[model samples]
Target chain A: ETSAKVIDGKAVAKQIKDEIKIEVLKMKDAIGVVPGLAVILVGDRKDSATYVRNKKKACEAVGITSYEICLPEDSTEEDVLKHIADYNENPKVHGILIQLPLPRHMDEARILNAVSIDKDVDGFHPLNIGLLAKRDREPFFVSCTPKGCIELLHRYGITIKGKRAVIIGRSNIVGLPVSLLLQREDATITIVHSRTENPEEIVRQADIIVSAAGKANMVRGSWIKPGAVIIDVGINPIDDPESPRGYRLVGDVCYDEACKVASAITPVPGGVGPMTIAMLLSNTLDSAKRALKFE
Target chain B: ETSAKVIDGKAVAKQIKDEIKIEVLKMKDAIGVVPGLAVILVGDRKDSATYVRNKKKACEAVGITSYEICLPEDSTEEDVLKHIADYNENPKVHGILIQLPLPRHMDEARILNAVSIDKDVDGFHPLNIGLLAKRDREPFFVSCTPKGCIELLHRYGITIKGKRAVIIGRSNIVGLPVSLLLQREDATITIVHSRTENPEEIVRQADIIVSAAGKANMVRGSWIKPGAVIIDVGINPIDDPESPRGYRLVGDVCYDEACKVASAITPVPGGVGPMTIAMLLSNTLDSAKRALKFE
Candidate 1:
């Protein structure tokens, strides 16, 4: 079996982040200005806190100021709105990210919509979504997860125009927009979801595959084309007593098997996961640059 | 060779237009008000003029008040904006449509964006496009052409859930949004284009096929599933000495070849074409209803 070349999402993402850092330093030195990101942490979930902390560290590493707001899990809906309102009005904050899975009591939709589109660096704003779909043009801010997936393909010199591409998982955050993005680039795209039957056959036929099915090993070597580039977005936890957490994170693709058939594939831990944070920073830098008319 | 079912686009469109007329009368009598559409016709292309005239007559047939603005071929950008501004503030106008294919010197994108979203009956507004993509939850008004194709399928009770559906073509105006609307209703969709190396093989696998390739006889009946539902959105003009215009209209799929193989199908001129205009009116009514908070 021929072992496939692993697409180094980690290294590529690091390179991008490093480039952003240099540009940010130049902006501060030349114009006495630095990009700022405001993160609204709505609850005490360990995952959300970790993301907030990492984002702040990323901001500091890049010379961009980071504002972190850690809210109680019991905070009311209005309590969250107040923070969004403040960020919207603040000139210093160029980007705003509200950690997801807000408490069930609060309306996630309404609060997310409250962030000014200009500061919606996270790109969950409806206005950005609209702009992205209109005329198949590049949206000011695209949802980070989808953007990251597409960037990996683009940097690898993969062509989208008129290519047969199949995407699994149809969630708004990943599948739908990515499909639209690919279409904008004029790729022939097919979207299969939970409702899809014989998804294996569909995947096997595509020249490229983007798997976000969250089910460990749902895609295997048999499902891939010999020269296909595969991007696995699923991070599923399965039982593995050998690991300290009593479980291990694996992507939707069975990496060991996929590596033999796929021309190139992304790894589980170091793949798309790291790119998400990097894209968030990129979007913030983009917002800053657009606002300052630097680009 | 098995003959294909002839899907009648004209009859379907006529029925839809009649339905709109009835609905318009009901709306008018109920609130002592009628739906209104403002159309800006730029330049004097014969085809565009005919489309505008048809739309005006359709509006009158349905109790909708039609407002026409015929600008000269050399109208400046400011001139177009002025018309948009007039429609934007007009309380009587519920929808605005600026006919496409403006003169070479005009910027269509800028003009399209000028219409207020509430009055953007054509559903080309960036805000509306984003709303359609976000979570596929609350779409403002889906793009007219795609929305029309879906409405015909829905009204006819063609089940798409868990079905193997393949869509040929990916234009923003038709293929992309139609596929999204289908997915929202739980259909598994695959988009195939000319670039697809094995379109025939892919189409054979689909239980439902939507052909908008804009090519004559691109989808052969032999490629269709035994009982697939076919929706043809292609409107290709082929040269024929038999016709007075020295041309004849045909769909992307071969009609004679498709009808026998497919359980159901849509015809070229009478099928999905009429629904395009009907949905435009429907969207206009939707625009007014949402604006007036009529539930």
Candidate 2:
């Protein structure tokens, strides 16, 4: 049986960070300015804090200044919005990111809406999403995770144009935005969600498949078309007492089985996860360039 | 061979207008207020004028006040933006629509972005489009033509949930918005565009297909799935030298051929076209109720 080639997202992410570092240095030399990314984290969810810290570290590595605003778990929506407004006015801040799961007491939609469109590095704001939907307009920022997936495809020389691509989920952050990006790349796109019937059969027809359903090992080997490429975006945790964390991270696709049938695939731990931070740094650098009117 | 049932969009539009007229009357009686729709036409394109005239006539039929602003063909972008600003602030205006295909010199995106999201009856604003993309949040207005397509399916009692649906074209106006709406309705959605390969085979699998590609007779009978429901949104002008104007109106689907294979289908000129105007009136009424805080 022929084995699939593993697409190393971690290596590509490192390559991109290195490229961004050089650009940041050139910009600093040319304009005596450094790109700044301001992240507003409401609540102290261990996972959210870890993600924010990783983002800050990524900014520092890329030579961009990271501005961290840690709000208490019980912070008022107004408090969060005030910080976002301040970041919008601050010329030094090129991108404003509000970590997700902003306290259950706060309205997620309303709070995300408060972020200015120009500095919306998270790209959750409606205007950025709307511009993305309209292929004619270039959005100030593309959501990080999905943008990372596309960059992976581009860097790997995947021909998205005229391809039969199926996406297995429709979440705003990953599935929907990635579908939009693929469509813009001219792929015939199909989106399957919880309500889809015969999803396995539908998935089997794709030349390229992106599984983001957050269900561990939901896509088995038999569901894949031989020689097709797969990007598994789901980072699902399964109970495993053998692991240090009491659980092991798996993806929506059964990797061991998929690697045998697929032509190319992204591994769970080294796949989409690393690409997210890489794209965040890229968006921040791009935002600063646009704001500063530098090429 | 069984023939398909013709879904008469004109009769349905009239029924909806009548329903809206009754509501308009009730609002007038309860609050002594009438819904108002403002249309700004920048150029003298015959088609744009015709569309504006139809919108005005539809408004009058539903007892809504119609506000019309006609600027010269060479009107500056500032002229149109000034009118949009006026309508945005006008308390009487419940819905604001800017006729599309604005003069080439004017920036369409910038001008449309100026309309307030509250009164964006045309629903072209990015914020509204973004809101639609997020299934959890409902936009103040859905683009009229796409809303009309969904309304036809609802009124016909064609189940959308769990159905495999295919949409042709990806125009922000129709194809993209309708896909989002169908997904919201729980239909598994696929979008095919110009660069799609094996378009026929992909479309042939759909239980419901919406063709908005603007290519006359592009969807042939052989390409349809047996007993499928078809909505033809394309309004293409074909050169026929037939009875009047040396041209004729046709849809993306081959009407004579599709009627033979499909279970239900909408005819071109009378199908999706009339629904657009009806939806505009419905949206205007909805806006008034929302603004006035009436149930």
Candidates in order have lDDT scores of 0.84, 0.93
Off by over 4 Å in 2: none
Q: What is the lDDT of residue A45 in candidate 2?
A: 96
After superposing candidate 1 on the true structure, give the runs of residues whose Cα lies further than 4 Å from its correct spot.
Answer: A159-162, B1-5
Q: For candidate 1, lDDT tens digit of each residue in A1-295? A: 7887887889989998999999998888878889999998876889888888988898888788999888999999899999989988887889999998899898888998899988898777777777777664557798888889889988888877867789898777887778877877777777888888888888887778888888998998898888888889999999999999999999999999898888888899888888888899999988988888874
Predicted candidate 2 versus true structure: per-residue lDDT over A1-295, tens digit per residue: 9999898999999999999999999999999999999999998899999999999999998899999999999899999989989999999999998898878999999988888888998898888888899879888899999999999889899999999999999999999999989999999999999999999999999999999999999999999999999999999999999999899999999999999999999999999889999999999999999999998
What DockQ results for candidate 2? 0.83
After best superposition, candidate 1 residue A21: deviation in angstroms?
1.3
- For model 2 chain B, the run of ten residues with the poorest summed lDDT: B239-248
TM-score per candidate: 0.95, 0.98
lDDT of 1 by residue, B71-182 (tens): 9999998999998999899988999999988888987778888989778877777777777766645766788888878777777778888888888876667876777678
